[model samples]
Target chain A: MLELIVISTLNGVLFGMLLFLLSSGLTVIFSMMGVLNFAHASFYMLGAFFGFQLTKWIGFWPALVLAPLLVGAIGMAVERYGLRNTHKHGHVAELLLTFGLAFAIEEIVSMIWGKSPLDYRVPALLDFPAFTIFSTNYPAYKIFMLAISVVIFVALLLVLKRTRVGLIVQAALTHPHMVGHLGHNVGRVFMVVFGVGSALAGLAGVIAGPALVTQSDMAASLGPILFVVIVFGGLGSLPGAFIASLVIGLVQTFAVALDGSLASAFGPLDPSTGPSVLTDIWNVTIAQVAPIVPYMLLVLILIVRPMGLMGTRES
Target chain B: MRKLTLAIAVIAPMLGHAASAEDTIKIGYIDPLSGGGASVGEGGLKTFQYLADELNAKGGILGHKIEIVPLDNKTNPQESLVQAQKAIDAGVHYITQGNGSSVGAALSDFVTKNNTRNPGKEVLYFNYAAVDPSLTNEKCSYWHFRWDASSDIKMEALTNYMKDTASIKKVYLINQDYSFGQSVRTDARKMLGAKRPDIQIVGDELHPLLKVTDFSPYIAKIKASGADSVVTGNWGQDFALLLKAAADAGLKVNWYTYYAGGAGGPTAIKQTGLDQQVFQITEGFANSGNKAAMDYEKAFRAKVNLSLWYPRAVNEMRMFKAAAEKANSIDPVKVAAALEDLKFEVLDGGTGIMRKDDHQFLQPIYISSFGKLTESEPFDEESTGWGWHLVSRIDTPQAMVSTTCKMTRP
Candidate 1:
């Protein structure tokens, strides 16, 4: 039981941190621009494929740096030519535009790489076991993932919170005309924010592609859960996103560790005699319903508090 | 729905008869050509197209060219019905699909309903890889023929092999939450209990299908249970991600899976360096020491850029031809009749029977372990420098199981 708790905690924290790393860019864009970049995950995917191809051309180390840069550059171009024009048409237009980009990006990626999972490996340098929790050997690659996630979170906090550029960007978001009158390049700031947001997503993909399966559908699989995290965290709050990520991650992990069911909690009843829905609920173990916990929480949060756990604004 | 079916029944045959005059036999290939399941679907599509080309090269079936009309279902059951309707409108007599059993079930029912509504215009649904046992048993249709072994049969064979292995004391079950995965879990538990009551079941887990990105939590639970073996029916990204997570966490346990031979499966297994520890139960593998099958596999890889992942597809196509020839017609109803109780040599050198009772194929199923290859095992998967070493072979009798299918003939 002790081993279960300790190991589940470790795994949950690691997974939670991965979730954060994945959605950090999305959070950044949504917070600053108030327009959800639906293609953010697609940018992450581009980073992964770019990372894979660049790793082949150069190496994993060089590719890690270059992949995000390329993704960020592409993101900047999209913002300048694409999102900038669509911005005047309101959030729906922006949403639809990004949504379309997501599909187009997925198709293009498939055409280039095919629908196969790339044979991207963890660099030999960090492939060994970092430490053992009980008998389980946690790879150094994971420790690196956790460290990178934390560093990026802190770095992002510093960039958006403490820096002069951060202040100008935040001011530019709500008061673009004022920032323009103050002689700051408002349009350039917006472009940089989107670029940095996308680059962060790309960085996530570069790191995560090796950790998880790198395929065209990687974006779609994680897309819904990413929204759940952002919404549950109370949109546009970095710390909120972080906390939500960890909470959901921990909830899912701990739920998997528990084998409790309705039958176990109450007296034994014949599950087969009941309707399928009732039987399903009665027979289902907590481990089986771990995936549903987040959505359940999403519903609960929406019902209980629409502003979410940490939202400053009511939506 | 009945009204729509009647409308289609009236209009579809006119277009169907017009297209049928072109001297081409069309097989509508419906599966997920786009989305998470697309990799497996695309591979299946390529395999069937190759088979169609091969059959065409051999003077075609009854001098009518075998043409495959590809349709993307996006792995949705409703979308599959729409695609089926589209195929029927375009005059396709035969439709084959194998991915999600839910989609398979939907198509099976749709084909049956379509055939009933449109008497002279019938379509046969040939399933290559959807192995939900209910499809061949309680939900079986005269119009639906399965080339793959049911999940129950595979489990029976798997447990028969596991009954002798004394090392597997505690077994863990983790599968995707769906019809096929649920069947694998229930079948595994039931068969294991009957075969080896001494083997304690440590954990039985079912996660959402293709939704999980990280599997460390599941791996941690498996470690906590102290299981010596894991049995899963996870495929595509699910299988690959699970194995990769197991590798990352350094979880050492024998993996007995339903689809560890999928596209990225071998690469993930190789990365783990788990030499021959992962076992999968399938109809056949590349390095089964069969010369003709090996030559075909080589040629297939050279042409398709993919390993021969679906030996059952090869069986399905060849058997379809044999049935067509025996019936001496490509008419769907006559062909369906000819397919029943038909016997043909499978790709891996075994005579497989298409059982008349449930329209299920009875053939030899092989259990192979992916690991280091020997001189004799010439073919490796996904260029991993490792291949499937034949561990055990369950013959026709061992692989066969009784069915309860009650079909009403057209």
Candidate 2:
């Protein structure tokens, strides 16, 4: 029991760190622009695919830097040429634009990647087991994922707190009109934030490609969960995204790890009696509900605390 | 007078066709031609086209030229229904589909309903690869004929092999949380329990269908369970991602799967370097040691630029042709009637019977694994150089399990 708990906690933390990497960017973009980037996960997917392509030529290390940069630049172009045009149309239009862009990007990805998973493998350097807990070997790639996520988190904080660009961006986020009145070029700041946010997502994708199989529908698959993380973490709050990511990740991982059955809990409840809702409920085990835990939390959070765990506003 | 003219306009085409009956027999090939299932669906389309060409070269089926009408469903059930309706509107009475069982179930139900409502315009749904089991069992229809082995049939063959393999003692069950996945889990547990009562069931886990991005947490549970083997019915990315996670975690366990050779599966398997540890049960694989099958695959690869993932597509096509010839008619009703209890030579040198009970095809099912190519092996998946070698061959007698199909014939 102790070993299972230890392993499950570690695995949860590792998974949470990756989720933070994905949701942090989303939260930042949301906080600054107040336009939820539905294509954020799609950009992450593009990062992985681009990283795979770049790795084919220059290898993994260079691809890690280059792929995210490419994705960030693409995100910036979309913001400048695409989203900017639709900005006057209201939040609904922007959301719809990003949603449509997500589908379009997925289609383009399918066209190029052939609707099959790329053999985007983890680097041989990080392929070995980091350590084994009670005979369960944790892969070094996962550890690297955790370390990179932490580094990004720390770097993001330091840059935002101590840098002049950070203060300008922060001020612009709160009062874009005022920042522009003070001659801070708020548009450029928004564009840069969008780029950096997208870059963060891309970096997450680059590292996550091998860990999670990089397929065409990858964006669609992980995109919803990333939204859940941000929403649950309190939309637009980086710290909230961090906490929510861990909460969801840990909830899901620990849920799967749990072997509790309703039958066991209720003392030999037979389900063969047929056609009863209670019977149906009794038949379900914790493992079966693990995937829905995040969404369930989202629902509970919205119902109880609309502002979210650390959120200032109801989004 | 206007109503008469409208009726005449609708009747004009039928009258024109009656005067000079169509020369070509159209088979509406409904499958995912785009989106996630595109690779597999496109491959099926190519095979069907190839088979049409092959049939046409030999004077077509019953003196009519074979025309394959390809429709893209985008792997959605509602879209498949729309495509099916369009195919029916195009005067097609023969349609085939595969890929997703959910889509298959929808198409089958739709075809059955359509056939019941419109007698002469009834379409025969020849399923090439959707193997949900219930489609043939409780939900069986006379209008539907499944050419591929159902999930339960495949699982039976798989568990039968596991029962004999002494290395498999502690087994785990992990499947996508859906109707098909549920069926796989239920059948596996029942079959394994019956086969090897001594084998301990370590863990049974069901995650959301196709929604799992990472399988590490599931793998962690599997590791904790101390399972020596895994039985899963995950296809597409689910299957590939599961194996990738297992490989990354360095989990040394035998995998008995239904679709470990799906698109991108070979890449994952190769990355893992599992060699012969992973096993898959299918009607036929890329290299099953038959010269004719090998030649067919070579021509198919050269033409389609994809490994023949679905050998049953060839089987289904060939059987359709044979049934048409036997019936001496291109009418779907006549062909479907002729297809019942029909036995024909399969691609890999074996006879397959279209069982009258459930309209299910029973053929020699091969259990294969990725390993070093033997002298007889001809092709590999995704140019991996590591072809799937035949591990065990379950003959028709063993694979032909009883079904609960009470199909009402028209």
Q: What's the DockQ for every one of the candidates?
A: 0.80, 0.70
**Candidate 1 A-chain TM-score:** 0.98
Predictions in order: lDDT: 0.92, 0.87
TM-score of chain A of each: 0.98, 0.96
Q: What docking tier does model 1 reach?
A: medium
- Mind giving the per-residue lDDT tens digits that candidate 1 earns over A109-201? 999999989899999999999999798999999999899999988998998899998999899988999999999988889899999999999
* Clashing pairs for predicted structure model 1, backbone only: none
Q: Which stretches of candidate 1 lie over 4 Å from their true place?
A: A270-275, B1-21
Q: Tens digit of lDDT per residue, candidate 1, span B1-410?
A: 99999999998998886665587999999999998889888999999999999999999998888899999999999999999999999989999999889998999999999999999999999999899999989999999999998999999899999999889899999999988898999999999999999999998999998878889889988888899999999988899889988988889899999999997999899988989999999998899878889999999989988899899999999999999999999999999999999998888888889999999999999999999999999899888899999999888898988999999887
Which RMSD does model 1 reach against the true structure?
6.1
Name the lDDT value of residue B18 in candidate 2: 66
Best by TM-score: 1
